[model samples]
Target chain A: MDLKQSARDLAIEYLLQEIKKGNLKAGDKLLNERKLSENLGISRVPLREAICTLSTLGILEAHQGDGTYVSDSYSEIFSNIIKKYGIFDRSMVDEVFEARSLFEADAARLAARNHTEDDLVKLEQALKKHENALTDYYEEKLKDKDMMELDTEIHLGIAASSHNNFILEIVKSIRYVTLQQDYFSEQYTLDHEHFKRSSIMHREIFNAIKEKNEDLAYKKMQEHINEIRLALDIESIRRDIK
Target chain B: MDLKQSARDLAIEYLLQEIKKGNLKAGDKLLNERKLSENLGISRVPLREAICTLSTLGILEAHQGDGTYVSDSYSEIFSNIIKKYGIFDRSMVDEVFEARSLFEADAARLAARNHTEDDLVKLEQALKKHENALTDYYEEKLKDKDMMELDTEIHLGIAASSHNNFILEIVKSIRYVTLQQDYFSEQYTLDHEHFKRSSIMHREIFNAIKEKNEDLAYKKMQEHINEIRLALDIESIRRDIK
Candidate 1:
């Protein structure tokens, strides 16, 4: 029932409205502080806070001694913001897996159709990294962190090969959440058996993409994610009982 | 390659690292500004900017007489930030549609299985609103703005019924972008036929969800989104030729 609007939010909302109304536009310099604050009918403190917020989000760019201007680099900003803050809860684990199952599987299919030579090279390299990480884990030479990162790298590589920015960003955001699993829960120990099995699945997914077998790539990726999800489902159910 | 980190970014990163290392906990008040700024080897100016930025994003909260505190409300913060800046480019139209096709179809299926009575009531109301908007549009009484909003409401309502916060937030972000289609392009005019057809699809999808027909709900939502994508593809192709 708290309908209060913070001063900073009001200022931010005003600027967004101007942008939406076409009065403020990409690359357009904002009005100087005194004039803007006067026009907004608020003091400069909240106004400055609003600008800082927008600039941090990369929606606005500020040049020292010049002024702030609307930014045209929306794509990168969008990716960075989502990657940094999109997933933050332990309860969101199942949702993340569900999202990855749908999006990453489709990404694999698209990669099979659209992957460039460079993408194939990257995917191969990522797969190699996963295998090495798995070996190192078995030999007690690597930590679970390396295994998790390498695994994610392969999935992100496939998302890149899909040539769809949305998939790449979405995968990155959700994968980031999964990587932080160790941060939230007891350190997520990667067993040698699980690591070995994951490596095998990654190899199969990579080979499918390499061979341009779209359906196989999609199915393999789905199975791999589904396998992981099964383990997570069991863990969550155990937690509930506890 | 600009490798230089801005002062504000440095401060923000330092704070995030502290949180990650468990040195700072949610609801814990931040160190006093003077002490924190000294610790970071930076002046208070950029530090304040960092705090302001996080506060605006809801990652941190600032109280006037008290101090800034790490916030536990990360889910709401994640949703707000993405909804505000996630989709920012004209080139992203195709990507948005592709994401929607994958996520929303799955969400519809989940909704069929998981929706509650309240969810059904909300969805029904959204459907009625859409029908009314279409009627108003046909009668020359409604603007494209109302129609656009009403249309997105139904999709968002379906996403809510999925009972997955991730799906709800994702749908909200993407749909917010679509709503700005008019802001980015020359106003998007919804023709009578397109509106009518969309309304029909919404009703069918709603019925499938209401009847708890998971596969049918998924199929209907996919068909609905694919139909929209087909038109978009043709438009993009035409634009390329021109």
Candidate 2:
């Protein structure tokens, strides 16, 4: 176990150095497993584990039919690492939300300034999915999980439109953390009323971004996050009273 | 070797689970090594390595003589982990700086709203050290490293005053990544004129935060980061021309 773990670390460290030295680069495909393991003088198992870890960290992307390519996006990397280690817990929910509020507010402002037509198309598509989910929740009895995931997609789309990978990654991490929290899920169950409110706010924020209204985007995003945060606070207060 | 590595990982995972379950907590000291090793059914070596890893990740702290305690700051943890794994490199410097600009601008605004008197004292002390470094740059000839470290201290102090751990941790991670970049240090040599300009801006930021001027604090921080970024851009362009 020790050897395998150290070998995995060694493999990961070696690949990172290769990336750092520009021997490996973004979009470069990985060597085959047997060859890479032979080159590293490690067995296949640890090398595979290393690759899995890197993939989770957004440093690599695996294609369905081809092979893994270096992505090096760094978005979702930090929080994903923490999540993989199982260190994130309920106590972190508030901090994650607080960070999300500030991050997405700025992201909205940046999106207003920097988003391209393609970015707008992607965001609009995400918003459309969210609205469809809301309708399905009331009509076809859609699962809360699907709505929640779509909700996150809309937020992430805005972050991506900001043309800032760092902001996008941070927002991704925040969403990942909150999504993992049990109480967050329980408190944020996608009831129609809650989904309706979120849908309306998401549209307003999206429109501000589309119209290039930086101030309005920032303000609306802040309001949207604050409403959710307030709901979380109320749930916790009620739990305490109980 | 495989056994040792897995043991370390098992120890880390176990501790993380404990923290997540509220069985361990921030500020809680650990059992002695022998007891912990016995409890985990691992040898002392892997257990120690696990402790070391956690300490590097800011999830644990080891005193000079006392046993290790859980810190759980999360600040510096993510970047420190990436650094440990050799994942961070020169390619990340620009993104780190861009994120720092947006994060610190909001951090300054939060500091203006949240800073206590003690926070002001820390900021003032950090500023004083920066000014001293500036004076020594001309007189006693301070090394650029000392000046740069002090410069980071001032910025981190402002982030710390923001009263948001998530913001503090993100800012900490940004500083950690930039500090590790070889080109960053080479490009950011603290010439007297540069130090003087930075000193002036740092003081203005500190004063704005002290006076509880959130808007001014945010604006000043934005200006400060933009100045540094502009200098960086010019230097890169010059290097490219060369």
Best by DockQ: 2
- Please, what are the lDDT tens digits per residue for candidate 1 over residues A1-242? 11123777888988887876788888899999899989988888888888888887777888776988998754345445554554432355556666778678878987898799999888888888788666667887876666777777788889888776666666776676565444222233323366688889988988999899998998999999887665443465335421
Q: Per-residue CA lDDT of candidate 2, range A9-44, in tens? A: 789889888886789888899998999999999999
Docking class of 1: incorrect
**Distance from true position, residue A118, model 2, in Å?**
1.6
Worst 10 residues of 1 chain B by lDDT: B183-192
- The C-alpha stretches of model 1 lying farther than 4 A from their native spots are A1-90, A183-191, A211-213, A231-242, B1-90, B183-191, B230-242
| Interface root-mean-square deviation, each candidate | 6.2, 6.7
* Structural similarity to truth (TM-score) of each candidate: 0.66, 0.75
In terms of docking quality, how is candidate 2 classified? Answer: acceptable
| lDDT of model 2, residue B196 | 78
Question: Residue-wise lDDT of candidate 1 within B112-206, one digit each (tens)?
Answer: 97799999999999999888777778887976667767887899889889877666666776666555444222233323456788899999999
